[model samples]
Target: MSQNSGTEILRYTAFSADPAGGNPAGVVLDASGLDAAAMLAVAAELGYSESAFLTGRNEPGHDGPPAVREYTIRYFSPKAEVPFCGHATVAAALALAERDGPGDLVFRTSAGPVPVTVAREGGELRATLTSVAPEVMDIAPDDLAEALAALDWPAGDLDPALPPRIAYAGARHLVVAAATRERLADLDYDFARLEALMHRLDLTTLQLVWRSSSTVFHVRDPFPVGGVVEDPATGAAAAAFGAYARALGLVPDTATLTLHQGEDLGRPGTLTVELRSDDVRVRVSGTGTRIEG
Candidate 1:
């Protein structure tokens, strides 16, 4: 761990090679000595959308680094702890890759075990994380209406092809698609109402999306529950959206989709999502860069 000002917090940006782009995440490679409260305090001080802490690792003989590369990871937002966070996972994997070289790593998260593979893509390092078995469930009519009201969006503004549903990969998210790009661009919501709704529904973010092509989509995540107005780039929500799209038959059994996110926020990043015919789990890949202080 690199200590600065008596604290070891590493900053990285996921889904983009440029430090100015993508979603920034704080990563603590070694947090074994810190408790949950201390970890949360660090995350809050960083004020990123999410922060990752490597609380434990299975190392043989107390070696320099684990040969198996299995780690116990925890994610925390400025407000509370979350089951999983994709951007932070990617950031952490890239951080480890810089030290341990590119390879496979497994993270034992609160939700489940997430396997990540890191490799050099072109001039930058990229990480692909295979999410836990995803599930898509119907949204209650009342809940859907309430969510729409919170966003001040009418039912008519929704895309008929993409129905509203609740999807879970590592964390729960409400997937809602707009009929037009213009509608998706205008995002001004009632933070308190949305936060309350998300708390009641146990949601991390609202995956607001618009399809620009058969395989290209634009997405935005409202994360009032995380104490962030909006997530610049949300990898967890992208994975859930992939499951939602596949369940709706919007994509083929095996396909690749590109998600363009954070453009409106000026931190544009690209996320590549892959779905296999035999595997129910979704794979999301993106490059990450170390954020300079």
Candidate 2:
């Protein structure tokens, strides 16, 4: 066993019920003593792209049900701290569910308030997170061209239907819809260039997508900013993409969007995005399993 001093680390893969699939993240149940530097060190040691540090709790004798859990949660990558993370959120929710049973959970993040719900459906336990209000914007032509060049992809490979836009729900991501599955599958990009651009634009990841159907899409996220080359499955980007589809009238008023991700990485996972007619906060659900220590 390796000698290290810190909080107990639990490993789990989010968005997939199997341990082999989805995005793996380190979960720290309580990070009371750990500071920012300590958290970063722990995440670097784990090196699972992103790790969650859970700090604080609801006041002892507070209001009924506790709408606000008062968590000073932080997300650390191998290099630095991020404002928010999607797959890590799912992992955190499932971890909470294992101990507290299936119910509603509130996570107070650096970005904003995130509400997650867990329920048992058959043998699988599904966790759904309701994102903050979402918004979308146009991508600058020069930026788009540079991004395409870095990916070694031609502009013709882009989908005309979905187009390109910068989307934001809990965090910001640039949504670029590819014309074909082949275009989406091949993901070799200039890491340094993309990272520089993302840093300049204040982007979390590039939400590269391909529309399989009106209600089905395939997604791959490039997260150079987080010090990860690619994210196997990204729940926060999904929420932002869902909002993009709805706002642009790409899908029906009430629809179930199935996202197939991580196939190219050999860690296939599924994410279900539900868009409601009345509510703007998108619901993203998926299954996760604990990774053996």
Candidate 3:
């Protein structure tokens, strides 16, 4: 425990070194005393897409920061709790790294245990989080149609290569790709309609993307389920997309994909997704920096 379980929330942006870029995530280093309601209230107060709370170290009787290695982590959106959150995980790990120095740590999330490795590259600290075993499934016809209707995107605008699917890494995301970059850039959507569909589907976000190249993609995330219009940079969605791509054989099993996001929102950030043939889990890496008051 770092603080008195008081209001010591640290803000950080993940996936981008610049505080003004990436997705801003509020991190409560120690929330041993905060209940679910309190954590939700804190997340709502922060008004970020998602926030992370470190409930406690996994090991019992571990005193001080020196003895702690693994942690019990929880994630919450402004509206509700999520099983996992990648950007927030990155932010929380970076916050710990700044104090304890870069190293390996495990976060016990609702989905599964996520192993994170942090290292300093040059002057900045970067972290890579390995997601839980991923699953990809074909989207329901009705659901696919409803999603397209909510976005006001024509069926013809979808890229045939990518197809439509629901992918799960730490959280579930609906993966859809636009045939053209222009189609992806225009993102005004029916929030209520999309929110309803997402709720029914039990999805966290819609992974909207356009393929810039075989290994590079421009992406966006519609997070109406999280009570947010869009996520600036979504590491969770990136991880899910990695699984989707690999499962569909859109990319080689062993490949590194670059995701460029938040550009249209003016909070430009980059995320790297690495896929390995031997492992069903995906690894997402990015830089994070503290947002000082």
Candidate 4:
């Protein structure tokens, strides 16, 4: 642990290098002494969508980047803890790059081990996280109805191409594509009702989306479970959605997808998702900027 035992909370915005573009994440570079309660308190105080805590460091893996680069990371929402978080992961990576000079960083999370790489690409400090093995499941009709009611969205508004399904890369998210961009932009829902449905289904967030093209999409994530109304740019959900697209054969085996988010909230951010031909792991990339005090 660093000599300064007091928790050091570093603010970072993920998905976009610009501080105002991506989702802001509070990062505690060294969380050696803080307990669970303390971490949660810090997260709540910061009031960002989520915050990341790096508990410690470790030796790098065989296929991993460095010889001695390992970190145990935890994420907290305003209300509670989550199994995993994408934007926080990206934010943490950029923060690490600022200190250790950007290479490969491995994070040991409750969900699993996630590998991240940060490098300068075209004057942009891009960070990519390889998600845990992905999985997808069908949404039951009854559950879909309940979810639709919660969102106050009629069943007819859903896109026929992308049916309601639950996708998981690092965390589980409900994937629901809208028929039109206009429908996607209008995002008002019963927060309480959605929260109840999410709790019942063990969903981390609702991946509300609209496909702009074969490789581009617009997304919004409702994170009631984490006690947030919406996430500007969610890495976890993007990773999961990438898997969903691949499983449905919507995109080629190896393809890159762009997600435009937070526009409706006026905090527009972009996330790039890549699906490899040989691997089930989805790679989500974004730029993060340090949050100045």
Candidate 5:
């Protein structure tokens, strides 16, 4: 138990094998008595992209028995509570795997039920989470213009192959593709303006992507609504991007995509996004490691 909170707050980085190479997240394996305020406080104090809290097990509407590894999970950002967060989910699942052994776990989130599978591969444990059924919608022209303006990116720099869209897999993200890798590398923007636009559009992050190949691409997330300038490796956004790619015919229905992220931030991480022909939900897999303080 932590001295201040009286609960063990584990720190881990998701989507990378190296502790300092991924998006760091705070994980509280057991947070039964904490209220929303306490959870928010914990998240704010950690100052990570997000933090996950396991509320409890054997909820009223879960699928498995009381003894099963099923629990209600909640995610909180530094500034507010979010419906879902991918990196934090991976961090929490890996933390649980360290204690309870890895297999299958279901997290009932505010958005919906998310199932995660953890397996030991060689010396490291990797986890894959199946996102909720994804949906992709077109962004309005005026809204697109506003987003581009806030980003200070010219419309001509937008990729013609991947149209602008608002994608949702648990949380909403605006998908904007850069025509070139150079355009993706330059990330300076009006933080306040973008934050205002994201708030009005109810966007969690802007999934800025650039295609390197059919299966390989680079991604960056501007998470203004979460009170962060950027998210190094975002799981929810990656899941949403998979759906967007499939919906826009950018990739085949059943294909695997490798997403390279956080490189520019000097915290490189890789995320694998798999789309199955039989399932509408996307799967995001990555390696997580403990970040010792």
Candidate 6:
């Protein structure tokens, strides 16, 4: 725990090695003294999609390396605290790996306990987080219609194979698939209207997707509920989308999917989603790099 008034706030971009090619996240390695207001202030000042704060870590009970290092983590967006955030989690894991050698880590988040594993891959540090049990639920017809209207997308524009639904891994997201890549790229929507609709649905972001192949996808996230127009890379949405795909029988029970996001924003990043045949949890993996000022 760091009690100093000037706690170091590290900036790291997740899912990409290049600083300008991924979603940037503010990571506070130690945030013991900062209260909720202070955390919110720091996130608001940074104005990123989300920031991660490491409140404290438990002592190593056993001998070598301990089984897993448990830590308390909190995620805050610019406007409010979120239940879980994927990009910030990756950033925080890489930051920890820099100090302590990579292995297994458990983060006690507001939503639940999330397990992350960090390892060096091809000279770059990569982190994989196992999401909590995922679930897919049906969306009300009226709500879906309202959301489509807000995005100015007609019902016919949606993919008949992929139906609209609400999916949750750590956070809630409305999964809507676009019929074509062009439709997904052109994202000019009423911010206020979409924000209101998302708030009413208790959604974190609208996961807009276009399937390029059976296992390859392009995704965009409209995050007006978080005070952002769009998120360059959204890990939570990716996890939910994985659950959505599995629920819809779009992919086999055990499969790995690739999600390409942030390309339209010129900050391209790749997120790998893996689904296991025995586990209901989703695994999201990506590489992260520190952004030096």
Q: How badly does each model clash, as a count of residue pairs?
A: 0, 0, 0, 0, 0, 0
Model 6 TM-score (2 dp): 0.97
Regions of candidate 5 where Cα sits further than 4 Å from its true position: 59-68
Candidate 2's residue-wise lDDT over 165-186, tens digit each? 9999878999999999999988
Of candidate 4, the 10-residue stretch with the lowest lDDT total is 1-10
Question: Tens digit of lDDT per residue, candidate 4, span 1-293?
Answer: 11223677889899876778889999998897888999999999888889999988875568875663789999999999888999999999988898879898889999999999999988778999999999999999999999999888998999999988999998899999999998898889899999999999999999999999989999999998888899999999999999999999999999999999988887889999999999999999988788687
Query: Per-residue lDDT for 143-249 in model 3, tens only?
Result: 99999999999999999999999999999999999999999999999999999999999999999999999999999999999999999999889999999999999
Error of 6 at 215 (Å): 0.2
lDDT of 1 by residue, 1-293 (tens): 34634668899999999898999999999889888898888889889999999999986675576555899999999999999999999999999999889999999999999999999977789999999999999999999999999999999999999999999999999999999999999999999999999999999999999999999999999999999999988989889988999999999979999999999999999999999999999999999899877
Error of 6 at 109 (Å): 0.7
- Off-target runs (Cα >4 Å) in candidate 3 are 1-5, 60-68
Clashing pairs in 5: none
lDDT of each: 0.94, 0.88, 0.94, 0.90, 0.94, 0.93
* Residue 89 of model 5, lDDT score: 93
Ranking 1 against 2 by lDDT, winner:
1
> After aligning candidate 6 to the native by TM-score, how far in Å is the CA of 85 from where it should be?
0.2
lDDT tens digits by residue: candidate 6, 207-282: 9999999999999999998889999999999999999999889999999999999999999999999999899999
lDDT (Cα, 0-100) at 48 in candidate 5: 90
Candidate 1 Cα errors over 4 Å, as ranges: 1-5, 61-67
Position 231, candidate 1: lDDT: 98
Instruction: Name the weakest run of 10 consecutive residues (lDDT summed) in model 1.
Output: 1-10
Cα error, candidate 3, residue 197 (Å): 0.3
Candidate 6, overall lDDT? 0.93
**What CA RMSD would candidate 2 show?**
1.7
* Clash pairs detected, candidate 3: none
Return the clash pairs for model 2, or none: none
